[model samples]
Target: MTAPKANAMKKTTKPAGAVRPKLAQEGFFGRSGYFFARALANLRQNVFVSVVTVGTISLALLIAALFLLVYVNLEGLANGWSDKVQITAYFDKEPAPLAVAALKTTVKSIPGTKSVTFISKQEAESRLRARLKGQESLLEGVNADVLPASLEIRLDREHRDNFAVTHYVAALKKVQGIGEVQYGEEWVQRFNTFMNFFRLMGLLLGSFLTIAVLFIVSNTIKLTIYARKEELELLSLVGATRFFIKAPFLIEGVLQGALGALLSLLALAGCYFAFLHNAGSFLGVNPAGAGLSFLSPLHLAVILGGGVLLGFIGSLTSLRRFVNV
Candidate 1:
């Protein structure tokens, strides 16, 4: 009788930890499947609200993306333009060819100067004629000797801002036989100031738009929670864990955000193509010359990631109230 009693006790205890492993396995699989099904059902049930929420997010993301694209291309264009921007230092008269070559070498040695090319008097005259094509007769009397030989100095990118390049050029004012250093100093200064103002405005607008998006998403999620309050309460009263309750809604939010991002990207692509077709000529972006590139795969990934993060954050914020209650 004692041996039988001990055997029965061991039998009962044997299933305790053994059952836990099986239950844990079942729980993981069961919860995952339930979460997926619930998320799909929720999306279908709240189709109208989902659409509105997605559309709003899409629009906001689209505007932000467009600005980002513009900013990237503008930076590229500015860098290209900087390389083209050069100062022409004109000599007093027709210096000897050897002296001009020596001056060119000296100017090229300057820290900011990338390249220096000497434009001879005759070449300068020819360029002037080409520029004033219709008025060639007006310049026929002037001799090549009258046109001064000049050194065209291309500066480094760092020196392209404001009067940095100008100051560097001014240092060569007393160089032998150099008459004057000419560049668009005033125009460059004004352009830099304008770019600064534009960047500041963009920053402010981006910040406001981001806040507005967060507010909209948070409110939408709160509404979703309110509509499903009864179901959540019932689940809580039962044996459903907090993670099990929240998983479905979190998945739904992610789906909404991903769809929104994809739709916005498609819309943006269409708009960009249309703009390129209609206004390519006016914009000076040649169709054949390395035309404008759309968002790369990496950028698309970033957009999708950003969308998912926003959705998760909004859902989490709304879920906090339910958790506390």
Candidate 2:
């Protein structure tokens, strides 16, 4: 046929007046739909790669979240221990009952003092008897006068720190009736040292983990960018706006981050419950009974938001190398 035209073999071209739709010209809803559709399509196009990226992010976040849980519990335990810290001042001679009451009133006015109780020699001896129930006969010669009378001072939360407690003790020494003021100097110093060391370790570990997450996420996104290099370049050549080219990628990253965070939270919940269930025999401890708690609402929000931020940062970092900005 005079040759059936080679139209079937010819490359199709748009009419001279035809042009691609400009997102800026569209309404807000239309623009949003376009972006979501494009992002979803990209995800579908590389389903396996997307899944892997999300899984990696979830695993990384899970490890960090787990450590956070442990650190929070340790902090709570430290606070509880701090509450038990008390200062006991031994008297050279038991103060008069009126003097003891006045001293108690004054100590209560001090910055860190929570409660103060006067322990008479007789009361102190009685306590020892109660404590040494099995060896009561050992106190045969011990009378009420044998045990020293003291004032027991319980400090408020803020004053439990070594420096604060020491300062408070010095203030006590300034009082007229006090002979010796002690708050377990050696033990307080050691407890503070341990707490400081533990906090430093947690900070270092958290920082390193954060860096690892950013680095790995960035490289993963970079790999994705490389896969679509030609398509992006072609769009640029056709005069697609920079925002148009980058919007889908940004959306994709946020999606991955959100999905990863949710998945990690679910995994964390499962692990936490499993541990709690088995703790009775495995660790011989009752977590709930000991005042251990799960993440608070604020903590949960921070972790979820952090995941989204990581994804956005990862995508942005990868895109900067491929796209101009």
Location of the lowest summed lDDT over 10 successive residues in candidate 2:
1-10
Best by TM-score: 2
lDDT per residue as tens, model 1, 203-286:
887788778777876787778777778878888888777787788888888888888788888887888787844444677666
Clashing pairs in 2: none
The alpha-carbon RMSD values of the candidates against the true structure, listed in the order shown, are: 6.2, 4.7
lDDT computed for candidate 1:
0.76
List runs of model 2 lying over 4 Å from the truth: 1-30, 95-99, 289-291
Report the lDDT tens digits of candidate 2 across residue range 145-233. 87789989998887887889889988898887779887788888888898889889999988998888778877887787788878778
How far is 62's C-alpha from truth in model 2 (Å)? Answer: 0.7
List the lowest-lDDT window of 10 residues for candidate 1. 19-28
In Å, residue 148's CA in model 2 sits off its true spot by 3.4
Give the Å shift of residue 226 in candidate 1: 2.9
Query: In each prediction, how many residue pairs overlap at the backbone (N, C-alpha, C within less than 3 A)?
Result: 0, 0
